[model samples]
Target: MLLNLKNIYKNYGKEPLIVPVLKDISLEVIQGDYVAIMGPSGSGKTTLMNIIGCLDRASTGTYLFEDEDISEMNDDALSDLRLNKIGFVFQNFNLLSSETAQENVALPLIYAGIHKEERNHRADVALSKVGLQDRTTFKPSQLSGGQKQRVAIARALINHPRILLADEPTGALDQASGKQVMELFKALNDEGVTIIMITHDASVASHAKKILHIIDGEIIENKQGGAA
Candidate 1:
């Protein structure tokens, strides 16, 4: 399994005022899986995604990523796992305002100790894959919302991560732009890139091969063959 979470629970605050976020969450995702997690605001889906992406740990649970116990890893280890194994896409694009598209895409490679020459080459290739090769030198301000999101996607994939975790990827786009992003996601999934996307929109979720509906800190439904 690429990922496994058993009896997961997350809570915050002190003993007398503990606020539960996720409750008894158990899930398994294998290689090449394209899954969507659908939930309304305050449903704990973001917390679950944080755990899956190694950004946070469950208050109580067993999480195994590629057979390695995540609970046993330290912050540095978890950070390393996140840097090397997982790619994250956010609704806001998260690009450096001063950096060009190529520079933004190559940011992760800098931390990986890749030389400048190789970093630029890899970033260009990633941009090409996302159909943004011609926009490599453009800054975020120069691109449209959809183009910016594509740049984010290319940056996320630049490291060739084991899984792509997208949090409301299309939430910031217009109807047409969102449709284009979903089509790109489908293409990436078809190429065997595992994807786990979080979205409240049913139309956005339908792009995945499987959908997990979350409500009240619990998974209410697990539907298969979500894609049309």
Candidate 2:
């Protein structure tokens, strides 16, 4: 398994006023699995994503990624795991407005201590893969919404992460742009990328191989997707 979460529980606050968010959440994902988590507002999906992405630890229970216990790891180790094993795409394209597409794509490599020449080369290759080769020199302000998201996707994949975690990735785009982004996701999944996407849109969830419905901080259903 690529990821395993058993009896996970997350809570905020302390004492008698502690608020429970996720309760007994058990989930597993194998390599190359395309899973979509569906939920409405205040459903605790974001909190779940943060734990899965190694950004936060569950208040109780165990999480294992590639057989390594996440709860046992220190902050630095967790940061390394996030940098090397997972890529994140947010609802808003979090591109640096001051940087060009290539520069933004190369940011992760810089943290990895990669040389400038190789970073530029790899960034170009990643941008080309996302059909943004021509936009490499363009700033975020110069690109359309779809193009900016594409740039964000390219940046996410630049490190060749084992899993891509997208939280409402198409939420900010128009219908046509969203369609294009879904197509890109399909292509990436076909190439054996393990994708875990959080979306409220049934249309978007249907694109995954499996749909996991999360309600009131619990996974209530697991259904097959039409695109499987």
Candidate 3:
């Protein structure tokens, strides 16, 4: 398995005033798996995504990423793990308006202490892979909804992460743009990229090979999917 979670639990506030957000969540994602976690707002999908992406720690659980127990890693180790092994795509497209597509894609490399030349070259290659070669120099403001999302995808792939964590990736786009983004995701998944997408849209979730329905912080369904 590429990722494994066992008996995961998440709670907020003090013990006497504990508010649980997740309960007994266990999941396994093997290499090349294309999984969608479908849930509406307040269903705790984002909280789960954060834990999977290493952005937040679970209140209690064992998370094994690539067979390494992430629950035992320290803060710095978790940061490095997230930087090198996981890539995140947000619904907002999270790009800097002042930076070009290439620059936005190269930001992760910069944080990893990569030299500027190599970062630019690799950024170009990543953008081209996502069919955004012509938009390398374009700023976020200059791109359309679909193009912006493509840039986000290119940025997420620049590090060659083993897993892609996308949270509501198509939420901000039009129907046509959302379809385009989903097509891109399908292409990436077909190319053997392990993708875990969190979305509320059933049509959007249908692009994945498997569907995991998360309701009220619990996974209530798991099955082969083609709901589009």
Candidate 4:
């Protein structure tokens, strides 16, 4: 299994007035699986994604990612795991406003100690894969919303991560741009990238091969082969 989460729970605040976000969440994901998580606002889906992406730990329960226990990993270890094993795409693009698309996509490779030439080459290849070859030198200010998201996607792919976690990737885009991004995600999944996306829109969730509907911190529905 690529991911195995069992009886996970997340709580906040002190004992006097605590809030539980996730409740006994158990999930399993295999390699190359395209999964979507859908829920209303404040339904704890974000919290669950954080744990799966190694950004946060569960308050209780065991999380075994690729059969390795991640619950006990320290902050540095978690950072390494996120940097080397997982790729994240966010709704807001998250690009440095001053950096060119090429530079932004190559940033992760820089942290990995890759040579500048190789980093630039790989970044270019990734951007080309996302069909943004002509926008390599364009800064975020110069690109459209779809182009910025494409740049973010290219950056996520630079490390060749085992799994991709996209948080509302289409949320900040217009209808046409959102459709373009979803198609890109499907194409990436078809090429064997394990993807987990979180969205509130049913149409967006329908793009996944499987859907997990979350409500009140619990998984209310799990369906495969997309929606009927």
RMSD of 2: 0.7
Candidate 1 runs further than 4 Å off: none
Off by over 4 Å in 3: none
lDDT of 1 by residue, 1-228 (tens): 999999999997888999998999999999999999998899998899999999988999999999999988899999999999999999999999999999999999999999999999999999999999999999999999999999999999988999999999998999999999999999999999999999877877777888998998999998895665
Give every collision pair in model 4. Answer: none
Model 4 over residues 5-107: C-alpha lDDT tens digits? 9999999888899999899899999998989999898999888999999988999999998899997788899899999999999989999999999999999
What's the distance in Å from true for residue 126, model 2?
A: 0.4
TM-score of predicted model 4? Answer: 0.97
lDDT of 3 by residue, 90-162 (tens): 9999999999999999999999899999999999999999899999999999999899999999999989999
Judged by whole-model lDDT over C-alpha atoms, candidate 4 comes out at 0.92
Q: Report the C-alpha displacement of residue 146, candidate 3, in angstroms.
A: 1.3
The estimated TM-scores of all candidates read: 0.98, 0.98, 0.96, 0.97
Worst 10 residues of 4 by lDDT: 219-228
